[model samples]
Target: MTAVVDSAKRHTLQALLSLPSGIVRRLAGRPVEIEGNILDPEMQLVLTLRKIEGAAIEERPIPGGRRALVDAAKAVGGDLPIGAVTDLDIDGPGGPLRLRFYTPRNLAAVSPALFFIHGGGFIYGDLESHDAMCRFLAERAGVRVVAVNYRLAPESPFPAAVDDVEAAYSFVTANATGLGIDPDRIAVGGDSAGGNLAAVLAQRATRAQVGAPPVFQLLIYPAVDFAVKRPSRTTFATGFFLNKRFTDLTEASYPPAGVDLTDPLLSPIYGDLTGLPPTYVVTAGFDPLRDEGDDYAEKLRQAGVAVQHVREPGLIHSFANMVGVGRSGPEAMGRAAAALRRAVSTP
Candidate 1:
């Protein structure tokens, strides 16, 4: 019964997103004010469909909500064909972590690789949820994409995710030859909480003076400062998909009680930004985390780190997952991947 309902919802979203771009854009643009900020047409349409299809997962039980969110993302993003996709398990900080490799057909001998982490506010995503995005990056940038399935919150809290990121990166760099990747050209990236992990990992590697740190970091609307509040949080507090309630739930699960949210591992914005690799930060106008992402980018620039920041003024959180919704999703992802390719391919 549950599977049938999910299938129906998936088809509904897929059908809606298959409409012509202009029609989708026009439908999305119809004026409807919510929470002070006029929601982006694309986001508004997505959210409305979510409401009707019972696709909003934040309010559901964690296990079920995670599945629903993953399904919805996969449905909207639509899978892409890759040269080859392989799944393997590698040793991580806590235990074993699943890793998926998306290699373009006709992969090069020593291709650059992006270590991707999927976003779900720390609790609700997995590799399958981000398969489309990874394939897009792999195909567009002409790089192998290594997607990590790190441990989640409540079960694996705080430093667990960070540790898994480091472990996965270490495995990739150490075994680059076997994986057919360029060790020195590896990069790290993710959206939302996954971005937070990538950012924190870069800082940790820099501080530790790792001989071969990630060549680049791509953060998409990252949750940078878990401890502090920004204007965007209040301004876009209620209506945005990443609202206070959803964030609060995810935050609590990861930190638990008595844990300080300001810990550098928890909030990478407070960590040392110097000596990190070149970074490309993407921010969405309607996201509550926008200010923190912008602030972090500025700090990286001020610290003499190379930073390319792009803010999509008419987009909302998780816009990247709306690939079939319109051109914005693919365009944003394509631009980010192009920058990533340049950064990683640099001599």
Candidate 2:
């Protein structure tokens, strides 16, 4: 019976997958020019439309980047749940970092919490880009989620974003009681660059003696290694939402220009994963980051860390963020929520 239900659910989700892409293409046309390794204005416009459409449930302009896209989201997405949204300001190693909290509705006392990081290859994106996904996680998993708005690269380089993530984790663990959360049930999670941060936090938590250890680490299409050559990089480099040139631009924007690409914290697949927390790592079939995510999972398993790796065939790198726009978005959320529940329910 459970298998039947699951199959039906997947079929239903697959049927709805084309809606978001169509919506994005119609709203924003293709790019006219490509400049400085970044997508042309027209392509950026299309990307913005896709982002807004995917995050349409509770769209708002984040701290930086395009504003017109934000306005369009506001007009279409409608009001998100009140209790599910709140702003947070906390002191970090650099200074102050901002966060957005998404609390699940009708949850029990001392619910599990997820420290979520949004994806943008360490360059673009903010809380607004991931609002819908966060809400879906919170409500579906019955977990409180705090999405950190770590400083983007170029403005703040290596270790800066990592520092903010660490600070946010520290603050949350320290104030868990006040926030009505179980410190023991805290998990760290993210996609793309944010996924890299989550992986780093898992290592940091194991090394440092501060606060509760992460109950789980959830990485979705994580950019795990900067050096190791992967087949996906060459095969799926172009036409995908994330391309090699843009990825190079993003990496170049980081501070301490020419930072070793093999650094473990920056590219965690190269890091020691022996003592990291249990992990759930998801990868996309068509994403350039696919091999890295797979390698990270294999490394974790070899290191004896409990790891469950899911490779979503036919999916793209940013599919997790496309729930509002893509037909499979909601289904992806459901899978993630299930994983979070499993991780949280474990000792």
Candidate 3:
């Protein structure tokens, strides 16, 4: 029954993707250009489809929100093929941690790996929501991927997610041989809130906290600082998919009431940027969080860290999970995967 459902889902996705670009553009209507940045047409098409569903952030409950996100990811990504997947239980700061390891076909005996974290504003997502992304990166970048199911907020708020990821990093580096990864070549990365955690973990690594530092860091439209309000926040606040209302909900819940937003744990932009590993920072030109991600990349450069920044003007946040749709999202993500492959591969 599960297989049949999965097959049907993939078939639908293929049908959607097989539509001609001319027809997609026709359905998407006029392009959305904000501040000289044009939105990706394929992305616009998805937005058009979403407009029909018309679900508002205020009406979304946590459990339902989580299920919806996972379902949407599966619909688009559909458990893309991979050589191997191994589910492992590791010691976390809070009891046992669940991790899914991905290995691509024809990989080396031991290869570089990515410690991937999923994004959900620190309140929702888990390993299931990002399974397709993990498979995409592992298969495309030719690296092993370990996707962590870290603790979420409102249940284990503030530093709980941080503690678990830090502990997981230590375990991965210590047991590198057993996990079929090269310890020295491990990288850390994530999308959105997960990207925030990755940045925080990299900073801790500089302080000799999370084993050896990650060789590279990939942050996709990461939420770096919650303290300041950039113009983009208001400019693209509504109708761009990730709106201010939803962000407000996440902010209200992730940190305990009366907690400081500027604290480095919640916002890594306020922390010292020295001694960090090489990094690739991605920002969506139409995203509300654009300015902050751009700012973080500049700070990394000034701190003397090797940094690569890409602003996909036509793209929006969550492009990392957009493999099943139009050309632009996959094109943007492919560039990141290429960068990851370079970062992990032996010189």
Instruction: State which candidate, 1 or 3, has the greater lDDT.
Output: 3
Candidate 2 lDDT, 1-347, residue by residue in tens? 64454345334333433346555344445533221122223233334544544532113232333343233322222234635588978887877888787877787767889989987767677787677678877877778998988887777888788888888888899999788788889999998989988988888787774456888998989987877768888877776566777577656666366778788778777777888888999987667888888989999999999998998765666677655433354576579789998889744
Error of 2 at 41 (Å): 26
lDDT of 1 by residue, 1-347 (tens): 76676566657766666688667768666755534545566667787766666646888888998888877877677757789999999877787789999999787788999989888988889998888888988988889999999999878887788888888877887898799988778898999999998888788776764325888999999998878889989878876678888888887888867877788889988888888899999998888999999999999999999999999876789987776445667888889989988887754
TM-score winner: 3
Best by lDDT: 3
CA deviation > 4 Å runs, candidate 2: 1-82
lDDT of 3: 0.85
lDDT of each: 0.83, 0.72, 0.85
The clash count of every prediction, one per candidate, is: 2, 5, 0
The clash tally of candidate 3 reads: 0
Candidates sorted by TM-score, descending order?
Answer: 3, 1, 2
Number of backbone clashes in candidate 2: 5
lDDT of 2 at 155: 76
- TM-score attained by model 1: 0.92
